[model samples]
Target: MADALVSIQILPRTPNGESVIPYVDRAIEIIQASGVRYVVGPLETTMEGDFSELLEIVKAMNDEMIRLGAPSVLSQVKISYNPTDGASIDRLIAKYRT
Candidate 1:
């Protein structure tokens, strides 16, 4: 099995009332459009296809957010072949548990 792993963090430039939901939604849209097996953080949303597609989608998602006035967006992505499609992704949870 193969998968594209991504960790996305959105922060407001000024700690004001910024809607992170839109950013999250855009991320989802991008992931879906990419057609690759993915697991969103907090334990849920999985998508599965091409690594290239995932890359493109992620970039687009970030661009969309920037266009929507979120320049303080940060993203970290790691892609690897799972060999056996993971039933769960504890690695991410552990990494971000703090």
Candidate 2:
């Protein structure tokens, strides 16, 4: 079982004041490449995994934004950690799904 659920929204200040969609897309790509279970929502992306690993993913996403030419990055993160019993996205949201 996963030990944490983390939701992150990254805001990158573009180098030339361009659209941030592409940057956001790249961040999601990093999440996908990490092989963690995740959901991309309208405003944020949430992932389920070990608490430390998920936090590392968030750092990687922010670093990628800078590498992609953002002057700086801001990441808003929410975490639900249950080290003993574990946390799961499916278990939390299943009731809302059809």
Q: Which candidate tops lDDT?
A: 2
Model 1 Cα displacement at 80 (Å)? 1.6
Q: For each candidate, what is the lDDT?
A: 0.57, 0.95
The TM-score between candidate 2 and the true structure equals 0.97
Weakest lDDT window of 10 consecutive positions for candidate 1: 6-15
Error of 1 at 92 (Å): 12
Which structure among the candidates has the greatest TM-score? 2
TM-score of each: 0.55, 0.97
lDDT of 2 by residue, 59-84 (tens): 99998998899999989999999999
Off by over 4 Å in 2: none
Off by over 4 Å in 1: 1-16, 43-47, 81-98
**Candidate 2, poorest ten consecutive residues by summed lDDT:** 59-68
Candidate 2 local lDDT, residue 80? 100
